[model samples]
Target: MLAKFRQIKTSYFKLLLLACLGFFLVSLTLLFIPLYISFQNSIVKSVSSHSLKTLSQTSYSVEFMQESANTVAEQLFFNSTINQLLYALDYNDIDTIISLNTLNSYVKSTLFIESVYIYSSKTGNVSFSSKTNGSGFEHIDDFYDSDYLKTLKANESSRFIPFPRITSNDKLVYSFLLPSSRSSDLMFSNSIMINISAKWLENTYKSIGNQQDDMILIIDSNGVVVNQNAYAPVLADLKEDPMIVRILNERVNEGYFLSSMDGEKQLVTYTSSPETGWSFVLLTPYSTILGSFANLKTIIFAIYFSIMICGIPICLIVTKRLYVPYSVIQNKLVDLEVRYKSNHMVEKQNKLHALLVFPSPFSESQVLQLKAANQFKVRFDQPYSMLLLQIDRFADFCDQYPIRDRALITYCIQNISEEIIGKVVGAESVQIDRNGVCMLFNQTSELQTRLTPLVKEIQQTVRKDLKLSVSVCVAESGHTIADASQIYQTARESILNKFFKGPGCIVYASDETAKKRAGHSEYQPARQKQLTDLIMVGKFEAAKKLLSEMIENLKDAHYDYFSQIILTITLELNNTIQLLEKANELTLPFQFNTFIAKINNMGSVEELLNLFFRLFDEMDAQLELKKKSKNEKLVQEIIGIIQRDYRDVNLSLESIADLVHLSSSHLRRLFKKETGSSIADYISRTRMEQATHLLLSTSLSIANISEQVGYVNSTYFFTLFKKAHGITPAEFRSKYATT
Candidate 1:
């Protein structure tokens, strides 16, 4: 046994295997700890991402409901018949009943609507569907009593705000007062409130939430906590909540935070709805995300323990074989080294994922932590170049392919780009987003010279293989790793503006925009006036064509110059919008702030022009519709007035026109065009119809019936009445009498 022990110790293969085993065991301490932590992080990150996505989907449901409410309100506001009804002093006639039918139609059209109320500023009497009779707010005090309601009333510019509910179970009613449009009548400025089911919203959230312990909250644009859940604290004001303040103050659209709440650790995921400006927040216990790893620790211990148990016999067998398996051992070590590198590369890819798609404001220390954890080969301090690749018309491509096929296409594109970029730039790349893949290369003396052809090569390869067009934007030289973010921004901006260059267009950040035209020049004042004139004329297509040419010419100019041109165009566009607004005497669709936000986001002039084109088209369509609506409404009003006061001798074209604030001549022409009859003829026809009805229904004398039908001259009334009916009123009565 002693001799055997000496032989085992002396065998080089046994010693070599033991040495490798010892190193591997030590690596378990160093590697497995981080690996376990990394795995834990991966799991937590995945769950949190899932929760955020689920919350976003739930928010979409809410947004869709809000959209329905907004659409209903907009339709009601623009309805001329509704306008006329609201303008009337009382709802005590047949017209009032017709208006009621119209209101009920709106309520029935939307499935989610629990109740709808229209509050008249003029009458101070509430007009709402009777379905809400027992639901409170029968009196306006039920709404005006709320503090936020009072605030909304005070602020003319307030958007749709959530009216406070008595409890969490109370349905959500987003209320708003229509701002005074071109119509000077007080009736047109009525308030609107739409109620949706609280149970539905709650259930939708519950279904989206994977965890039973999760809590959801929805706050509207007014910072009012519109949604009530047991887990959420009702804020006196939503701004009072630190999380809300952080979200608002920081100006981040969405993110996650870990906090100590109610003496336990909680993870909060929050996002803002673009459609409604409402904040959706979700709170879940930290243990739900972190404690899932308890079994992972046991599994890791078992793995290490089993490895230790298996190594003893292997070492004993290797001692007997000695040097025979040395080559095999070397090959195995090589394979293990490759696997270790592969693991590290995966970690690096994850870190890069955060940097690209999410672009968090990571500090230097955090970056360094990522560096150490990922073992990234590229140094931030080194001179670098960036290549941003965007698959052109990605939206259209997505619409053409199913999800699984699109995934394959994306995978193929990424693979091809990576392969070509690797060959060209020596292999450094990160897929930051689905359509956007970034390539990083250390700057060489020939880097700038090589960048153009290299980008084209990859672009051509993707096009050839996938039959897709991709636009490449290059940042040929970056000063340092700290500047990488900025370089990426510049490159991204250029690529986003690809609409101006068209599909498969290439842009370089270092070209004329970055280096040339540093000197600024002021455009002539008349230049703006000319652009404004085109807009005022509603020559949207013409204006856009002119703008396209201007942008193309400015390609060689500085980016600042391009921005100035766009700003000028935007300002002039606003001027034209205001002109049309004043002329039409109505609130235009484009709010100034909203317009500014849209313009600010647009990097390319083509994008701005496209937006302008859409808005202009909408304006044309809306204005034309409004015109037809007003014309039809004026005719209806004329007819309604005639029917209501057919016996009044004073009723005439001038009197009806005065009530509608239109000249008699214009009203007559418009009425004739709309109704295929002149005002005089329509009024006479209406009066004659009444006379015939009275003659048939009653034993009233001819003179009294003529007088009742507004004919002071009985002979003239009889003659005209005979001409209209092709017989005397007495004959018509006898011919069609129900009796």
Candidate 2:
């Protein structure tokens, strides 16, 4: 189970599914949070605004009614009949009945008034009219809400005040008390009380505007509910209530707020009537405001939950489908990255090579190449030196190993060199060619002390592991990146000093010995003329002696001058051979071109000296053979004349015999007896030999080549060339030119 859990945790499918689900949830949250906030704010604002507006209208209406009540009270207070009835000390049944009729008439004049009372404090008699009872006179103490008389008498400063009272019919009424006199002794004065039914006020409050579950109240300055539509009792002390407390503390004539009342949230809007000192409070429960939002929220949540329930599987399917291509692309990207890394390394190697081989005082492209190499961490902007390592006896090395082994061997050398050098300094080693590996060393402090030991160690390691030898050429320190190419070239040139230094040696380009022999040449024209003179006069012993001495002398010189010495010698020998052939002087059968070709395969100067000695012996043997045969000499004379005149297209056997001072028939018989072919055949053979050489060696057209080879007809020459080499001249050249 644990393993399975681990597998699931690491699974690509699981990761993708989780990612999709996370994104979906985050998107929903992002969309829902702000939407919820905005919707809630809008709903609250709308409900509060509507409730405030209703409260305002209700307050205005109540204020209007209070003003109307004040107007009625003013008119009633000024009436002489009501004043006479209240101030009269004694009265008959007629007078009392007339005063009751007047009170009844005043009550009937207003729609909100239920009854009116006129009280005479001197007699303690109250005359009252009611909608339910006929007009009558009674003591003020015996009246329903008769305690209001005490409340009215106690307030001296108030000429008129409103009070709530309950009648014997259990109906609510608001009584407005008006004094008949302004004297401070209110008990001695007459007063009037106008009763307004709470039912009428409630109906008026409802008529203005109200909502179901909405509470409306009219609270007086003493924190008592003057009129109650809902939520609180009539005349209840509601100052401690949360909603009422906030409303009262606001100290503003009108305002709205949200509060919690009876464990339910409510929007409370209140307005105060300045004339009545009564605050109109509207308590709207949040349930009413959020009712529509609740339905919308339900629908939205249902849809959202359904989508979330269905989206899991959809996300799974989508993740599966997407993961296929994603996996493939990821794998392809990995492969591309691998290839890119491989190509990047190769590019770095190529750029480093370009920097090493670039000309001095670097060009723009070479500078760019160096900069590119620096990007690869192959920096040359610091002090550095070049080490050129060439596998000694590279020709022999090739003869021993196959191509694969050679590559591995080269790689081994480069790895070992770089690894060892890397310990002490920053270095980059690149295999420049088959036999050469170049290393750039970035640490040059104590230059000689640092490089000498490291270079020797690298040589020792290569020789010990590979059982092969290498010659290392270390160039002088270069101060800047631009000096790398020149320093590398100097190392390359100095490495050739290995021809004298032999294998498994390190040669410094800055060494005094190497510097002294930089441009000095040991071989001279006088030595060549003397060697040629010895070979021409049939003095093989003296010529052999002279050749050995020259080879010995060249061994001590630089390899550059050594090569020049060999070249001059070979050229002189060819001239001497041509001189001998022309004068019929020494008929030495020397293949000089073949001999020159053999020089490259020589591993040592001793081998080269031995090769030259063998050449002299072969020439001596051929000279003795020529001296021994007279008939052979005559046959050779005829052959030589034929060879000399092979380019003369008109030359024949008779022309050849005339040049040799012999008759045609006799010359033909002598050539057949000694050479085994006719003179005419020999001439054709010679011309064909020249034609094949010219075809392979020159780019001239076949017609011009044919003319040079004594064939004026290019077609005949082409046929002969095809027959000789089993291919046409063009085909032969194309086939062998690249090789």
Candidate with top TM-score is: 1
Question: Which residue runs of candidate 1 sit more than 4 Å off their true CA positions?
Answer: 1-57, 81-148, 153-158, 161-191, 195-200, 203-232, 236-310, 319-462, 465-563, 582-585, 591-610, 644-661, 699-722, 725-739
Model 2 residue 250 distance off true place after TM-score fit, in angstroms: 99
Model 2 spans > 4 angstroms off = 1-337, 360-379, 399-405, 445-447, 512-522, 537-541, 581-589, 628-739
Q: Residue 80 CA error for candidate 1 (Å)?
A: 3.8
Worst 10 residues of 2 by lDDT: 180-189
Q: Which pairs of residues have clashing backbones in candidate 2?
A: none
Model 1 local distance difference test score: 0.70
Which tens-of-lDDT digit does each residue in 147-183 have in candidate 1? Answer: 4345335644545644445422343444444554433
TM-score of model number 2: 0.38
